[model samples]
Target: MDFIPEALNKKPEVLLIYTQRMIRGRTFEMIENLGILTLAAQLNANGFEAKAYTGITTDAVKTIKNMKDRLFAVCFYCDFDNQSAVAAIISYLKKHYHFYVVLGGPQTLHMTEKDLGSFQADGILKGEGEETLLTWLNAKIRGEAVLVPGEIQPAQNADYIYLEDFSKYALPRNEDVLDYHERPLLSVITARGCPYRCAFCFEGGNSKNLRMRTAKDVLDEIEARLKRSQRPRYLFFCDDTFTTNPVRLRKILSGVKRLREKYDFVWFCEGHPGFLVKHLEFIREMIDSGMVRMQIGMESGVDDVLKAYGKQASPEDIKKVVEICYAAGLPQLTGNYIIGGAFETAETLATTTRKALELLDLAPGMLDLSTTFIMPLPGTQIYNQPEKFGIVLEDRECLTNLEDFPVNHTKELSLPEVCMGRSRFITAVSNKMKEQYEHGLITKERIQADFKLAFNYGIAAGYLKFIYGKNNLMVEYYKKLIDYQGLLKEWHELSEQEKNTWVIQRIPDFSLFDINTLSQLEIDILAGAGSDTIGETAEKLSLSAEKIGVLLKGLSDRYFVLFSPFI
Candidate 1:
């Protein structure tokens, strides 16, 4: 450890700020920011006073003023959505404070040296912030700064700051890092870096070396968090590929299974498509181990487009993997799709939409389609050499809007054109939703309920499953229909004639559920539910209020009925 002057302080002090451009107006749970917490953990283990806060949740300058300890540096973790907002905060802090200001995160990984000046921060560390950040901080304190005074540089192997023993730094003291007052989910990154090389991914070019923590270590962290009264009902594995290594994933999940028997929580994780096809059988073990949701990187469903993106699977294989998972009792599957690939064209777009729509037909509420236009971040292969990927950077600064940028990941179609194509795709999906509604898949009450709430039913389903068991079929039912934003907009466009209470009876398709499995009273409840609320059914059928409420709730849980607005 290096010596510091007594005038500065007895110990080096630093402040980590996790600032976001969004989340100010929205109701959200406080999340455990793993990136900043890990760095804070490293600082604390070595003798440094570190504090952190979200700029949106609390004021940055006020945090500085209220701190009892003096500070040497202030670091801001940036999200891609809030790049401009974070930059503004950095400039304001620089004007108001004397400490060194630095920015690091996913957004920084995409910026080059020329772009660093635009941020206006004192220094920007251009890679993973662990070892590089510590060395940069320690050297600055020792008056032997790594770069020429106030100069920003890219991270290189010669920095000699990598954490060789990753296990020591993997866990952080939650109190020192984040507040989990209302947040019921804890994000755990069991590993760092991705192995596959997908051209459009930032991890492909930036995060090179993959490091992992053992299964025992992960279970220990969960137990510790549980003891702290921050009982997380869900665990989101925030790794680039949580299911990359078969052996490691098995051990980790086995431990997770044991923990779930006591604490009771399900989890969500993202994986490469190749991995899913390779371990088709193991998916059951994943589901049985309390994995409710699986997100696959299915950027494009067309085989040709997938090939161009360097993804390993074909269109058939993509379809095959999802079919396998759904067959193995996986309740929900989310496939990510991008409209404007480097090789995107009208034909390929049609095929991709058709593929997604077909899967939606097969899985109904069990499948979620996450569709969007591709963002060409600076360090990506597409951004570095635009012509090579059929992209045109009309104005790189206009990144906040998809339509205003003028280029949409490909020179073949302008950004607005891409937006229009995405709009049409959404309209098509909305039509599919209407089709499902017409097919007796859902009750009129659910349709009325969704339209009223702007269709935000997916989030509630997960929490509902905690109260109702994972086996409850209704909680696994309809996600806020695919393209919910577009669906909301479509509702706004609807004339009074199109909007509801203009009800055609959403008579339950009795063939969909097994009547034999239901009891005589439960069967009578469904028969009485037509065009009538549960209250009305109870009165007309002369059923007791308690019997009606219990039976109705049970039916709703089993997917035989919906008790949305009408009831």
Candidate 2:
């Protein structure tokens, strides 16, 4: 259904706020602004004046207050980097603004109505918020009692609350409300939910039920995005597994090719080894269709560690998949490795480290090492059996911030050993990979830079091992910086032919934006384009000279458009 923007009389005022890391921070390179923007579009279509307020500082909120009169406010809270900032906003809205504040997202889904009351939210939209939020808002527009589907119907006597399917309703124009500031990338969600069970995981721990969109449905979304967005340059498929079924993956790859021929975009998504080997041909097709990268969840290379985490695939399975991806020209692949999970001992951790080294040497892409500590979430099996895992249940305060606690402790290894091992492995493998790449051991520069990042990352890993153990900011920072550096080096080194081998390399992911937030420009220089004159690009894009000047200045600062020649 086409969403018509209703005026003040016809529509109810709806304000959507996204104060999470996606809008505010630079630590994570994400695609979707979670589901907040998508829910906002749904509200807008249902005769609600929806506007997204992101990374709103105190001054920014004051300015927004002056701009729009509010009726209801919605905030998506997913354990954001800045919870205090978002909590303050929520507090302000309820106490001063007198707005009906609805908190939705992963954090809300984890907490019951009582647990979420601490956030001071009037109501929490559990599960998928699209239908529930829209229903609640539409009812509010008519001055009806706000009741969310499967919402723990506020009652005197209730044993348990059953969640409802909010996905069945007409999804909002997520593409419409998605304000990219005319950036190069477009966020694409091909499917929802995962099929695996990883005990430490909080996102998919709630359920292992995989739900996919029809190939046609996904292709339609791509086509719509190609027409509506900035040429559909880059797509980040938010699906947990993009290659679960070979036949479906093949069909989607075929569709992606059809779209790529016209729109010319690249995409990336997460996958597992079990799916990759079964769909080798589709993997190749994915590469041909501009699928540049795969974020494979190779939690641990040790067979024992794999079994402990309920990862069905073994080290051999991962090796085979990584090798296949390399052959298919999917050169930028990253693996997620968990360090401090239940049943993880010092010896098992060492085996994981050694396994990572072995895999890094054999694989072709960049390997991202994630060393996450296991945390008991609300619905996961680990939460029910804390004693079985040797976790101290009495220490509730430790569990409050997952970053500070080690949820799983085994007798074989001290907490520090498990944590330090993760740091050591992340550092060692990363630096070794990069050092080999820098020394011309790898033919692909992108692959080389990916490894090169590990060198700098090792320094951070060393620090993490000393200070904050696993999943520390220093470790993460090292990984990100190394990745960025590697990306830049790859961007500079890859030839047009080599670059064309993968979809990600064909199109640029980063963009040039002005300080005023009024303008955004494609900073990606076309093949053979000289850096002699910035004015030429301004003319090509039909942009004003002033705008072009601003863009060039920004690009230069960001090192996107460099003046230096290759030695």
Candidate 3:
């Protein structure tokens, strides 16, 4: 997203806000504003100061107000989930704060002139922004004509700029702006762009060009990430297709193997089935390089659906990739499956579900999956030309829905039918994945590792919902929610006065129940909670332990209080 003005103050500091949209019940999977962090690192390298914040627009407005006049231009990584909030933030900041507002991210790749005006942002940066943002801002700082990266002409209509040499900027992941000591989003972007244009992927707008950082640079980053932390770290390769280039991949694996000898860490990456199959020899090397897990884009197990979606891999490739990873002794291999896509039929959906379960059965403990309803995000092939994919869009507004539901239906499947099919598919897969633990397939150590990983930065991963189903780490927590031997203590952050006067209605949403509010009794119980076990606290309150045990469990789940047996 980009249009830069040729005038601005040279006061070095910039603010990049990643506006979050909350859907009452569900939270985002992302623990941090990764894109904003990448841009912040870029600015730091260019002799400018920047900080990244992820919050609702209201919280963002307060952050800007706190900065007062230091903010000459505030940038945002605007996205589909919160467009209205971003637009409102831009309009208000421009009106009252009186600073230049720049927007970028997935939404900008598809925004038009009218959309830009409505957003009230000075410019929308399209495609990659690491280089463009710096170029545009630097030119404005020097009072030179602002332009796109590598372009001789002034920036015009929606532009797509790739950082040509991805190594031109700093490591895309930055920990300076992040205070997270445990999980600093140890994600690395060894490369950018995908060569394949899958019909539903936003990468289609990325211009189908692949640019890679040098192997030494990527290796240096992995070592840098592992150097300071003593605990086991999980690094995620954020590249869409980490296995795209085989020779480079081999070098990466070799570097990671060397690093593992000195650092306690494991890593995961998104893999392309087609590439993995072609370079099948690398699977063992990847696992040997501390690669414990892999995420695959097995959109469907039906070849017809895969073909219609323009995915390069066939169902055979998906099966082969899973078997290769599992047989190579890869501990875990999870793939993504689309339930309600353009060409989905009952038979195709069943094929995906049945075959997916069969794959899991084949590997038993090693294979798993996540299923999502197909939503045509803007700029994707289906969004641009639904007719081409034989999809009919019905509820356009559902595009921003945090919960997955069918928004479009094919000629063969009605909206309701698609919805039902998706529900069935998810239920079946989630159940099978659960058995990975219940039947002693997936281990408690892994589930615990994943659990800690989800909240490493103090926010739940979207997969928290699934964590409960796997039912491993929580067993002890549940057993001790009111364990008479354990004590109940308020989260240190809650003030004494808050406990004294706050009513049940005054409490904010709980992790357990944004839907269920605290009852008056629950409030009293919270106020009285302390180092004393609930059995003792109940006696003090003249209430039965069971009466308030469940309530305290809810409060404890939200971290309102730490009901021991948990950290």
Candidate 4:
């Protein structure tokens, strides 16, 4: 059952399951994912043979088997988008190979003890898996019993471990890292943790104290990546907050400005809206220096909800940041709003939605409304005071269902209402953003193709929803695809002559084929294989102007294989 060579017998073979979304259109592959890959490489370098499974590869079974029967299993349960898929895989793996499962990332780290029980995972790495996981793996390799941070109980006399520092590990190397295409954006982590204590966020609680690499460290990594490839289209800063410290961010930006003069590519990262406003000049400099997009977690429109979530900022802060971004000549700026919260009533939800729409009108930037369901995770105040907020964490399985349920409830809104309102808000905001992008309210100086891909997926999703009732498959089918920025490029780059319209025909090859409402003939016509005019399409579908309008709107939005209507 052992696969390691005799020379490496002392070193344990570890299987790190890196699950990714299956749908290609809906997912946006963030930079943080690279951290796990880097972690794997680090373990390999230390003598433990580590292999990663993205879960989308065709040979996933073989890949898992190659690493199976290893001394330990560390599953990097990173993205919450496909926890069910990961859960299924974990269940199957454990059933076959009784390996120790270690879970981390936003989803796993945030799991309620009950939810953790459901995951049936042996242990949970509470925060910052770098030091925690490395210590555990090292202990196991040496045949010392290992106990992870936050492990409730370990086998008798197990080796207990925790990381006192994160700086000891070098920034991960970017060479030979594969994306969906051979040329997917290079992801780099310059920093970790955020100063803000927003209640709605489960991701940033990993560290109370934020740490960042030196400007030289960041630039060195970028320079190494550039040496590997002449200028990949984008560099993603997967840090929780890249610009928390204006001076350091500016230093990185200044370094990038020099690089862009020669490389001429784009970069993006998340930020606090308040920070962006306070550092408007630096933001403008960053944009000019080729930082194309800045994402802000402006979680609520109502001032009360902002306070309730401990956001420590106002809607005015959101307004100021957006206005500054628009004025800074930044091509794209994205702001997030949480629809349901302690202060959110249906009426308040409406107010937040109204304020969001107004912000879009006033600021002239893209707007995105995040999931309303309040996700309660471990290490946060929300986990301990679930009763204070009417949130009960039933079990470890709750983490898998966070995207669907509100682990925490507010007096103002019921869970169902929050979910519904959130969906509606998402629809409204996406529609408004698409209109703004189409009307040229926001300029896309960088990653125009990526935006176009997102735009098309939105259109397709809208059309599908309009035609078929709003179903989970329809929603998940699109969300999964859009998140997979790397994988989409693989489907797209199959041939140079291949057009985007081919998705109408080719999408069936993937898992989403189950949700396709269009018949085989319709798919062929929609895919541009057969001659089907808009009128013919309308007639064949025999739907109302509303339905036809939805389809046309989606197609025009970038869903169809037709020319870019926005362009």
Candidate 5:
């Protein structure tokens, strides 16, 4: 809104609305809507005065009312959850405003003519919208007839926009939506489409061609981001498969490594198992270049389940990639699995659970796991023909809720059975973590960290109580985490030599001892007194030197603190 100039007599020609759904619980993690911004940039380049609204805010409505007769184009990029909001906005605009309403993005690809009629949109632009929208607008401006999808042209090939230089457009900043600590996390997209055609994925069916930006172009965008206000500390690459092309990946990593030295920041990305395994050396280079986390799509653990879903990787391939990432010093690796696919059965679910546990056992404290039920999104094979996969499509609305168990039931398994299988898998992984903690394979700190990660995801899915019992486990773990933080605070206040000693001794506990009751001399020694000798302190306190030495040794032994002469 601040970017729009009020002194101009003429009203803007276009208003782009980037609609986003209200994330039920995870409000702290909302990402900026970048698609609409890209469209705005394209329209501006073609001599159109285009302004963008992230959502249908009060300011947006006022701006539209003021320019009621002057506006020509109003475009909306909506997703599944936000379709209702977009419809309401479009209905209101049609009643009062004169501009043509255009609906685009993934949500529109599946909508039938009946659905489009409900919104009362003047035109429908499906698939990638930039080129279609621009061409339509140019024709309208020239007083020429403009044909849109659902009326004259097919939605699939409505002039998909693949920019040769993606960097020409300015990306979204969205600093207001971020939390205090999250201000530094910026999102950047290096590629447009995915190469793999996994049957369960909407991207595979929607993208006709895979395109990527040059590594130098991407690096230049990053450098520009660094110069902006509130400099970012992390870059989240929003690509579907960041490592799709190995040659480009290497050039990006090499450039990032050079830039990282000048501007200190880390990054997280999405990767595929096949690419990660084939390029271990590149993974290492990525780690060195501040790639701290990766989310890998290991859709299923059973080979049959994977093959049915058109996933090229096997269970063994997933395991190998996990092993390699852990060895490369990657701090966090998230293995994502989709249960209840076309070939999903009780047996396959069990195999998947076993594989998940095996991966957890492979790296006790490093790897993280996430499992979600498969949703038959529109344009995918499963959605078009449910009977071929032995599934019955009951309610299309259920597609909006992919985080939960599959709402539709397969011929081999009922709805209850599907829910049970998913619950069992989550419990099994959690129990395995508890078992490791009990056996001392992993510390309580590691268990707490893993649970925190799980809790965040559970909250997002609105299933925290269902997955982990009615807040009891969460409450108990939170108390333990608090206690650990208290101990860590005291540990951090110690001298460098004392801190080294604690690490060398595996972080011994001194919390049981009461510091308040100790004499001043005893407290000084414990606090690493600068120059006070044990003998002089003993003489000053009227205790024998032998007695003081024994006391010091006893304290060290009890706390597991090793005394190093080199310090």
Candidate 6:
């Protein structure tokens, strides 16, 4: 009656290594290395003693050293940013241990044998690794020769293996490998591969086919996970496009609604604007089914830019979808934007900024915006044929380094120009929000939440600037905000006109200045600065002399304004 295989206890062990990477200063998504955990689960099910080390503790080397004799294979779930770490680990294993080393994941797909040689790994698993890994391990266990697609050695059996039905594989359990006992969020994948061809996306562009699990299968997995975690805080659907198939999505929502009645949990998923608009009722159903948030990839707000990037929806489509979601009473909506893409010009960037502002205006307190420069990942059209997009690739090694913006030059803009443009766009959005706050359009609580979101963007843009060899003005501004909290509080207490003069005199760079600091009255005051006296300047601008005198005194103290001593 025992489920454990007798052979597994006797077989040599396998070690799966997963290193963490940060995205947008958030590690919530990376907490569980799902791919490796799924591989380990399959290995265990197939009568192999597999253990995983998720870099939670620095015991990988000690574990490997202790089990050197029993360790048969060392598998690494590689990431673009962790190439050096992977190489270091592989080199150490090769130098001391004799186990077969296997490299897999998106990073392996783009690397050549020469590029991989330094790591001294025995083989690499290209494409989906589940079936290939299970097949190779089974062959190895059976004392038969195995061949990997990109390896130097060839086996007698060279056929590739892929799981036709995704449901056959067991759902990954995060508690098995990840330190998820205390974590509130758990990520689950309902599907594999994306059908769309996004030029800036390596994953979607390289996805040969779309494969999905049935609603029953997904719901069963969710129910099991909830039972294990005792209903975790949130369930994140990590599918590339959760609503790509409306029929399947509706079925899934119905099952989720049934589950929600029994469990106290909320869920989040990613969706496209086209699908969101097409399936309005489904979105409402999802919200009713405890779907708290949906992240939409509205890549750009310019129609031409979206078309050039092969996006399915236009700016109008995105706005309409946002309006629909608002009408549907969705709790929170997050929109992702890519700034520098093919055919992007100053006018297009402005149009995009304006459109993004319009979206913000639509959902003043509900919308969360994330903006970034387009990265040309390997295997994408932009990467394979850079000349077509007028892109000049720089630092191929850094393609996977998403923390800092990757280096590339478009025909229309250089890397620095792109970085600056991205910063300006984010600043513009922040200013608009600030303006709303100043005019009493939005609550202080809303402004504070908006500031937090804008701060994250500032940190990202500042890192990008540092990468692009520009002064990290955004970073400095962030420091100023933290260091000058008292000064800012005092500045906020000043009348709207005084605050404007303070900002204009202190922060001369318009791009860096918060536009909300400048009111129409302040603009008029500046326009009438050539008058002989404060009274005349105030009269000219239709403002009181007392107000002008206060602004003039503040500016003079900062050496920004001067008065005629003879007068």
Each candidate structure's count of clashing pairs: 1, 3, 7, 24, 0, 0
The residue pairs in collision within model 5 are none
Model 6 per-residue lDDT tens digits across residues 1-567: 111343345865778887644432245234466788788877787777676666622355666677676677888877665667778878887877667888876776666656456667877676567677777777766668765553433322222233458777767776556234545666788887789888888768776577888888899988888887753357779877788888888889888888878876777898888777766677778888877678888877778778877888888888887887777766468877776677666777788888889987886555667786656666788878877776677765573455457477667887778788888988887777556544556433333323332342221222122221133332343334434444532223446544334332232334644446656765555444434445556666776756765666554332233333122
Q: How close is candidate 1 to the true structure, as a TM-score?
A: 0.72
Largest TM-score belongs to which candidate?
Answer: 3
What TM-score fits each model?
Answer: 0.72, 0.70, 0.74, 0.67, 0.72, 0.71
- 346-406 per-residue lDDT for model 2 (tens digits): 7767787887777777753345455666656656656767656544343432334435446
Q: lDDT tens digits, residues 62-89, model 3?
A: 8889874666568888666677788877
lDDT of 6: 0.65
Per-residue lDDT tens digits of candidate 1, residues 407-466? 455656766777777877777766775576446564334333333222222233321223
Every candidate's CA RMSD: 10.7, 12.6, 11.1, 10.9, 7.6, 12.1
Better of 5 and 6 by lDDT: 6
As for candidate 2, its clashing pairs are 430-454, 434-451, 434-452
Minimal lDDT window, size 10, model 5: 456-465
Candidate 5 stretches with Cα past 4 Å from truth are 1-15, 20-29, 44-74, 96-100, 110-116, 134-182, 397-402, 434-567
Off by over 4 Å in 4: 1-13, 20-32, 56-62, 66-91, 98-167, 174-181, 203-206, 363-372, 386-409, 430-567
Candidate 6 structure, TM-score to reference:
0.71
Model 4 TM-score (2 dp):
0.67
State the number of backbone clashes in model 2. Answer: 3
Descending-lDDT candidate ranking: 3, 6, 5, 1, 4, 2
| Tens-digit lDDT track of model 4 for 253-273 | 889889877774677777776
| Best candidate according to lDDT | 3
> Better model by TM-score, 3 or 6?
3
Superposed by TM-score, candidate 2 places the C-alpha of residue 103 at a distance from the truth, in angstroms, of 2.0
Shift of residue 233 alpha carbon in model 3, Å: 2.0
Measured on C-alpha atoms, candidate 1 has an lDDT of 0.63
